[model samples]
Target: MKKILKACLLHSTAVSVSLLSFSFGVRAQTPQTPADEISPPVTDLLFGIERMMGSDSTLVETALEGFEEKYGDAVRGGDHIQGIAMTAGGQIVLSYSRQDPSKENCSGMLIYSSPFDPASPNRELDWDFYCETSNTDINNPPTGLGPEAHPSSLQASGNILAVGTHGGTRFYYLGPNGIEALHPNTAVLTGGRDSTGLTYNPVDRRFYLLNSDGSTAVGKNTIRLCRSDQDISLRQANQAIFTDSDCINIRDVYVSGQGANLIVQEDGTLFLVSTFSTRDLPDNLLGFADDNTDAIWGAYGTRCALETALLPGYGFRASFEDHIYISELDFSNRTADLVMKRDIRRTQAVQTCVDKRPAFRFAGGVATIRNGALLGLWSGRQNPPLLSLNDSYEFAFQDLPQPIKSASVSEEKAYLFRENNTYYRYTDSQGVDPGYPASTSRNWDFDVEGDDKEILGAVRYDNGHVYLFLEDGYYSRLEKDGSTSPGYPVKITDNNWPGLAPYAERIRAVINWGNGNIYFFLENRGPFGGTLLGDGEYVRYNIAKNRIDLGPRSIEGPWGILGDYDTDITAAVNWWNGKAYFFLEGGEYIRWDIDTDETAGPIRTSKYWPGVSDDEDITAAFRHQR
Candidate 1:
């Protein structure tokens, strides 16, 4: 492995100067000792590198004194600073955010330490120093925490501090030492309650901002993202609002210049899920360059959930036409593969399930497309568990909306599903009502039926067929037409399903890769037969060979799961690129790869939308199909 050096220097002095004079292009002076020759402690070596990279001699000397004052002999031993990250270049940087009052000011400080060598083997110098700052505010603002500066994310790129704060999103162009706001103040994303999940797409050279669920001048709980990296004011920020429907909470957005998609998952009973985009339109509403606005134009979002889903080349697909997919807890199994296109010729196109028992269905999380596919998660569904999908409307293309409680997608035609338990696939089983008033076009119904009504999981058409996986381990195939193929659901054994662990109660979720495979999660019970029997376990199912590979269980015995298993599974899984990403209750985010057979993380966090944790009722994420 090639060794990289990064150093931090804390200066105990006040230094505010011009940016050009203190930029990153400082000359590397020939010290008495060569940096390549020193074997000093990593800390000292890193500190030395900072000094050498820096051009300010006064700042360097001051930092050295501070280092000596802080760590006497330890400075030579190099044992501090827990985390480290490097830019594509060799520039070393460190990040720490503190809302606590004890550090400098309430405004959190981000620091960068240059090359500071403790012993210069080439120059005969014993130690080199780097500079640090007390107040690292943007535009040299005051000591208080403001909206623009309460950074949710802080990254250093070139001479810029890429900042995405709760207030608005903007960048601060800083030299090696000083701060400069890059764009006009009015062009920033400073109006929102929170701005997070920011990405600086090098391909497009634009900064993407995912806004939190809050009120804007137009409505409440909307999703907005900006493409301009230099805009400092919210007004100038070219933003696309994903979900404009009333009370839609858009969570965690991702964008790539190749395509634009928004996933909106609401958080209440009948939670509205939808996806919107401008890619498929014939011409721009406000005409500009057709493909420019078609491909690279400014802000716009739509409300057609079905059109977003059926627009075939959507996810994991190479071609792109905007699409949507939705996952809802089916109290009555009648809501399977049901789609009601909004048209005057079709009445009874929309199918509604009247639950005999009390039920709660909602959306929890969603992801927009950037490079590969768009995905959304629907939770709090029963039987089939959670769901994942490439587009929200894929399941609803026909009259019987796929009974996916929850789902997420990795790419076009590839998907994951929860709460599926059927062995038959239905396609074009019913047609739109030819004789209907324009007022009742959405009231159409499809003619399809099977004992396999519950859909535990599904993968989009990789081999020209939408592969459906059920909870009971049944597999069905669906084609473009509304027809059904009574295929056998691939069953997983106790060794494969693993939920049969001595104390395990049931399997929790499943994801379908575009290829012929399925990944399943099992939640077990406690060792002593506690209220909750076991923790969650994972498994993969091979459709071609018909085999299941189970894995070790989780720490939280899976029996007494977080929410009610009677109606909702409370989790979702998605496959992206070649990896499977799973989101579950108790706020867990996990990923696994089939080819690599490696799992990434089980990171746990709460819901991105507010009011989700308050009621303890389950919340799901699903994209709305227009």
Candidate 2:
């Protein structure tokens, strides 16, 4: 019987994703009709916060409510919101300059930050952005722009913020306090002339600036990409290099800087910040607030890049008025890219600033409209598999003083870890035997220093043999005489392992599903170049054929009564109960019934599993014989 367990991991060392620690107040999760949300009228609407998520240049909208009333109207760019940049630490920067060369070129940039770090005191900023430009002008300014002129666009990465203008693009220092609006340094790429629609790529440490053909042909434009190696806010020289997709005209249609708005993700994948016109959708069906733009945008396609895609690039207008909205796009359909609003945010707990789709809860069952069509009254994934519980555990796990690194059933159940290069041998009869937790000296080809020496995951075969997985596609097995199998540490190649080779580097855990097949969980990272790489997908390896038998599939459900989880499914064990028990990052356990393929209980380990903490992370789990 598999424990009613369902946890999915999205954690990785190379990716550096901030764990979900933004607990501001009592988490009041009122289960309601799943739909888009429209926050109450906020005085200072700072930014529409966005994060580069998985699923091919996908952008997830987050709700951010509180704002400084004094900073009202600063974020209102009126189609002139040429650039919106986000820092690695979750700071949003917006640029809006008055297009008129008439008055004193007065412009301001507003920054909103909820530093992903839970440690810093200011990280809990109550969702406010400070206005520290040369001058301050709020609601009183004519058209709210307040003589705002060019710094036509903006882009950011790490701690550096770049502001682009018709003359040239300059860099500014973004310290912890606020942006150094006073000091402006020039970047080498934009020193000669004006540039707009710029973005930063963290993957390769390069800056991609959008260059247009400077035409006014309606719905037609030619755009290219400029690569800069100099670090942000630095003054260096490098010519604009355009080749392949960079040189080719994505779509020879449009005016100056009006093709597809450029946005490069951390993984160096290029995408367009596309939008849709939603004026025709019935006001009742769309459920938008009184104050908003005529259009809604919610997609960044995987095929909008220059070189590879044949379908035209350069997105259409993202908004019709000052306050724009975002909607979900149906990428699979591949027809009309845009869709109307539906509160997918409520299901994901995504807080945002300007998406007023509607309250998640409706009086009755609601109809989710997509692409001007009804998606039925039922909610999609109403709730991410929440491993929540009404009952509390009386006792906590005390055995694992340190988090388990790699666990497998072997001679006394081997647990190889990196705490000073040692492993623990726990027995079902006596628990930790005398002189346990010994060094990994005897493990052949392992027992080295650094990352190569660490065991990421371990699994046991029916014969009671143990296998240890290492970094860069290598694995070793234990022999009968308490020694590693000779000629071990072999590469898990396509010829040998077939289905698991390409992902050998990203595998976080392995499981021997007592049913004669092995399961491997793959780790995923975000916005790699063009797609969300390192997707947390799992594959089933058939022991009989020694190749992939089932999937490279997502843990999201329809998964045999096993709902998906937002957290990472770190480790699992084929328990003695004849079920597969899975463990998550937070000490929660669930199981899968081998016979029925039905799943049950993501109950806290504190209930039955001895010595497990509430928030303890389990790295490896397996059944062992004494």
Highest-TM-score candidate: 2
Any runs in candidate 1 off by more than 4 Å, and if so which? Answer: 1-97, 105-163, 170-193, 196-365, 368-371, 375-473, 480-626
| Shift of residue 53 alpha carbon in model 2, Å | 12
Q: Which ten residues in a row have the lowest lDDT in candidate 1?
A: 390-399
Task: Show how many residue pairs clash in every candidate, following the order shown.
Answer: 134, 51
Model 2 residue-pair collision total: 51
lDDT tens per residue, model 1, 306-380: 333444221222111222222221212312121211111110112111010001111111221111111221111
| Alpha carbon deviation, residue 311, candidate 1 (Å) | 42
lDDT (10s digit) by residue, model 2, range 1-626: 00011112121111111111222344266322111110011111111112111111112223233321332223332323334444434344445433322333234434344432111111133233333323232222222212134343344434455454443344554454454432221332322122344444445554555544332112223444455543422321122222233322333322232212334322344443322122221233345554543332211111112212332121222111111112121112221222222212221112111122111111001110111111111011111111211111100000101111243235455352332234445555655444333334423346333233556677877676777777667887865444577787777888867878877987777788767788887675456632254345678988888789887777556354333552366666675556777766666767778778877777886565543445435566555543
Evaluated against the true structure, the overall lDDT of model 1 is: 0.29
